[model samples]
Target: MHRRHAPPPKLHPHPSPLSSPATHPVPYLHRLLSAAAPAVSPGPRFAVEDYLVDTCGLTRAQALKASTKLSHLKSPTNPDAVLAFLAGLGLSSADVAALVARDPKFLCAGVERTLSPILAGLTGLGLSRSEIARVASLAPRSFRSRSVVSGLEYYLPLFSSSESLLRGLKKYKYFLSSDPERVVKPNIELLRECGLGTSDIAKLCLAVPWLLSAKPERVQVMLACVERLGVPRRSGMFRHALKAVESLSEEKLAAKVEYLRNTFRWSDAEVGIALRKAPLMLTKSNQTLQSKSEFLISEMGLEPAYLAHCPVMLCLSLEGRVKPRCYVIKFLKANGLLDRHWTYGTIVRVSEMVFVETFICPHKEAAPNLAEDYDAACRGEMPTNFRFTWTKNRL
Candidate 1:
């Protein structure tokens, strides 16, 4: 009792210069810093919904909907590990948010068994953390898959850079998820069998990466269809034809071919010629082809057969290059300056600099406003002189 009597005079903390010696005083500068700093506290006890909404950046409604799938998640331990790993990968908080929003189940993945291994394998493939982050953000489901490593292994060398691969992922969104052995590899081999070099296959990947990820059976059929379009496999246009036919089923391709035969007034042989010249025209919507046909055949006084032979003109912008140049020609004709014979190809096919130098610059003395009027026409406006009726010039 005597020893316990005086408990060391109930020692107190030294008073801070910034505050009174009451409760628990801290250092003067620390006290002032604390007083000035905004109060921060641990987040509200880790409800999955709360974490999804607050930490993962899902909206309240999205959190509510997505939380149901995560009902088995009792703690934030797994999600926390996943988030820490993603953060280490150089993904910004917003990128994590978007990736989670797109695939909430991504958080439930095993970090050691799935994510860490994927990171290590991709690192072995020489991809920097930023490139891996882009792939993860673009395809989270695939990012968690074991096959992703092999897919990137094959794709990185073919694509030559992570930038092109990311672009393909954005457009297809399923490249990494597709089975590398059964689907992607087989289809790529098929492309090789069809005589596509690494460069050609890489070019095809940029256009229709999904084609490589498609079933081998379907790819073979589509490749056959592309070959039948009369663009020889050796031609540079072969890859263009591959992209054109990749989206169309045999039925749709046939319908489009028949529609082309009817719209452009082409025979079977002419349809082949047009498709070979510009396979992209087959992918154009009916409305786009129809409008171009009407303009080239009716307004421009070109024959339908001529368009079949020069189908590249259909690929040109009717409003951008064709219409503006047509207006310039009409302006020259109205002023009687273009006395020489001129074809639409001569007027429309030259590069912009050449077109201006050849058509607009030469007539500077005749019409001072020709270049100015042409500039306005290129912007989709109709200058007054550009719209005037003029006698048609002989071709």
Candidate 2:
């Protein structure tokens, strides 16, 4: 019996479909249970990308880029509170968006611990709510910086008006990060040593706050540059010259000087004289210089030397003030109503009210369209046929 036992029956790889359920209850019940169980749900997920777009006003691309940096935000709780708090502080939606765009991390900052305290400190330093909103819009990181309080403490005293503070903050957001004792104080002292008065220093701060935060070496270089331009340190125009020189790079200053020399055929000395008279002329674009020079020299028959002497005339608007007034004067002279002795200097330098009273109002009877034509020219709608007779008279 043991030696002749038949081989065991072969088993199929799969169970037969016709097999009785009772015969293979384990496998059948396993399949049935699997089919009956509910699908395993995914874990709870945060929709940060959607949150950025729908709530924060970020574009899809901006939201994607900002999301990577802000991946830690598991929900919109913190950011929503931040936006609400900022809105309570009078920040518009656009302002909040600008702030968040500038520094997205600001959206995650703790409202009570970080943002509220900074705003309170700024308000304590006399910044109105609107100004705080502006500062936040311009430099959002300033709110989180530990140096903000100290920066405000040092700068608030320097500015007399809220407008000056606003301007300074808008121009130089790094005022919060800059070391007042080291950078600002030294630069201000250097300006004082350069013979700038308190009023002049205030004006400089209002005009160019970055200069106050300039490195000591750069401040020294700017001082030397202005002095080399033959601007007397004791002169009233010294502050203006310093501002002009500091505002421009050496390359820009050189280029502007060369442009004036080559275009106007002015000697280097004449160029320097012009800059001394009106340092702001260096701030004008090359296009402005070209247009004004062409009009004054080619059309008005004014000498290049006269322009170099009266550089302020070059600063006037070519279309608005200069051309319109010149047209009025020419119309008067063409009718023999204007005095031949009246100088271009007199015409260009008068206040707007005086100009209208003397040129536009009195000449209405002689030239009915004088005011209309002047208005048209001032609006940059110069008539195509507009022309003026050039006189060789000295002004």
Report the C-alpha lDDT of model 1 over 1-395, residue by residue, as the tens digit: 45556455654577544456553445666778989999999765558888998898888988888888898997899999999999999988888888988899999999999999999999999888998999999999888988889888988887777888888889888877777777888888888887889988888898887886788889888878987778887677888898898878889998999899998888889898888888999888899888888878877678878888888888888878888887677667767778697777668888999989888787666566778777877887865445633333322
Q: Give all candidates' CA lDDT scores.
A: 0.83, 0.80
lDDT of 2 at 319: 82
Which candidate wins on TM-score? 1
Pairs of colliding residues, candidate 2: none
Residue 179 error for model 1, in Å? 2.7
Model 1: residues >4 Å from true position, as ranges? 1-46, 333-342, 383-385, 388-395
Candidate 1: 10-residue stretch with minimal lDDT? 386-395
Candidate 2 achieves a global lDDT of 0.80
Cα error, candidate 1, residue 130 (Å): 1.4
Candidate 1: pairs in clash: none
Model 2: per-residue lDDT, tens digit, 1-395?
55888989999988776586656778887888999998898867888788878888888888887888788888778999899988988987777766776788887889888878888888888788887777777777876775787787777767767677777778787766778898999988998998887778888887778887779899899888888777778678788887777768888888888998877778888888887887777778899989887888898888888888888887788888998888777767776777556778779999999999987787665566677778778898887678533333323
